[model samples]
Target: MTDRRVQKTKKAIREAYLSLILEKETPKITITEIAQRADIDRKTFYLHYDSIEDIIHEFGRQETEALILHLEQNDFFDDTADMAALFRALNALIEANLELYQHIARTPSYAFLWGQIKDILKVSLTETMGERLDIPRAQLEICAEFYASGTISTYLAWLRGDLPMSDDQLAEIVGDIAYYGLHKLISPPKAEGDEG
Candidate 1:
């Protein structure tokens, strides 16, 4: 376990970095600025992190871990997994960290952060779903990537206010898409010649 003081210092550094990133581009933010904002000297900052990017990478790692943990705790990978419940849980997790997600959404430079998280989820889903569904690895990988990318993209759109739907509505729509393909979720138009 990490020491409490070390954990506290790291939290301060992360908070300071996040605050600065919100105001300007990551490349423009300096270590000196972070150290000053964090109220720690350059040496102290170095002791905790190598550079500003290190803090960003660490934040991604921590968030990804939390996501995986939340999914597992909610039985997302179980044989009897409930698609609606899983999506609701996922939405709750995102809503809980709205500030961090909003930061990613508003910053074009942080786009990779979302990709990184999605890639991790894809890997996890591919492995677990492959075992559960008894599908080939290659097929499972493609399916997992498709689902993960689609779900994350939808959530990002919702976060950007482009979707204009409530959280529960968004979750239900996404859940339907995941549980049933577009063709199944939406009915096809009947031919003009067809009569009832």
Candidate 2:
């Protein structure tokens, strides 16, 4: 019974927070406001959360976990280099939580989201090593770190409107770049009216 109650309270708090976020910025919210919105007392809020940020952090964790599961099921783990599913899942996630993304990106907790993605990629890529990478452990670590950073940076750029591409297009472009190198996405421009 206690477990169920705890789940209910946590769910209530998260739901309230989402509703409030849709109407106002996260900075302007408080425990009292969330309690009122959730129809719970301050004590109930504290019972399940240390602060609004705690709940938000947990929410981000839960969201990233879901994304990872989705990615794995789609065979993102088939190979260390199979990042297309990961990118697709990421695109869907950002689109689904655009408002929350805008809010969380403004807070210190924003790093947690990217951090989670990096960790997930590291683990998934590590798993894809059938018999361990032939490179030195330190070297492989560096490469994985670079790839994960590049993946996260691309999504961040998409969020910031650095490119006119849609999320799917961006994902595909990123996949091409990661798998086929820069030449896949860009070739030298031909003279006007030039044909292949």
Candidate 3:
């Protein structure tokens, strides 16, 4: 078990890094600024992390771990839970940490976090639906990628405040799109006489 002081220190460091990243690029930040923002000495910062890149990497890892934990705890792929529930759970998590996620969206080094979540979603889909699938392996992979990327992009847009919809609204939209495809999204071709 880690000491409470250690946990507190680490949390401070993470909070500082997140705040700094929001104001400026990760590459522009220095250990001194982080230490000052975190209210810890440079030596203490060094004790916890080697560099800012390490902090970003650890943050990404922790975010992904939290997501996986949330999924597991909610029985994400269980029969009782549907895709909408999964998306809602995800939206809840993202909204709960909106600022952190927004900062990460702007940080180029943390870009892989989106891909990591996408890959996890793909594996979950494969495990849940693979046995029932009759399509070629490549096709299944493509399908998973489509859903994963679409959902991730949606969440990123939400984090950036580009989406006008609330989390619940966005969740419903994503669930609808995933389950129903573009049938409802694409309007019937307008009659030749129809004019907007």
Top of the candidates by lDDT: 1
Report the lDDT tens digits of candidate 3 across residue range 50-106. Answer: 877788778767766777778778886664236776687687667777877877876
> lDDT values of the candidates?
0.82, 0.76, 0.79
- Cα-lDDT of candidate 2: 0.76
How far residue 25's Cα lies from its native spot in candidate 2, in Å, is: 4.3
Instruction: Evaluate model 1: give its lDDT.
Output: 0.82
Instruction: Specify the highest-TM-score model's number.
Output: 1
For model 3, what is the alpha-carbon lDDT of residue 180? 72
Poorest lDDT segment (10 consecutive residues) of candidate 3? 77-86
lDDT of 2 by residue, 1-196 (tens): 9899889889999999888876876688888999998999999899888888787679878887888788767877765466566678877778888766755555454687678877877666555652356877777767667767888777766666666787888888777775666886678899999989
Could you list the CA RMSD of all candidates, in the order they appear? 2.5, 3.5, 3.7
| Model 2 bad stretches (over 4 Å) | 22-25, 79-82, 106-109, 129-133, 186-196
- Per residue, candidate 1 scores C-alpha lDDT tens digits across 1-196 of 5699899999999999988887887888999999999999999999999878889889888877877787778777774255666567667777887877776877777778888878876876686677778777788889989988998888888888789988899888877877777866778888999876
Error of 2 at 99 (Å): 2.6
Worst 10 residues of 2 by lDDT: 124-133
For each candidate, give its TM-score against the true structure: 0.87, 0.81, 0.82
Clashes of 2: 0
Indicate whether candidate 1 or candidate 2 has the larger lDDT.
1
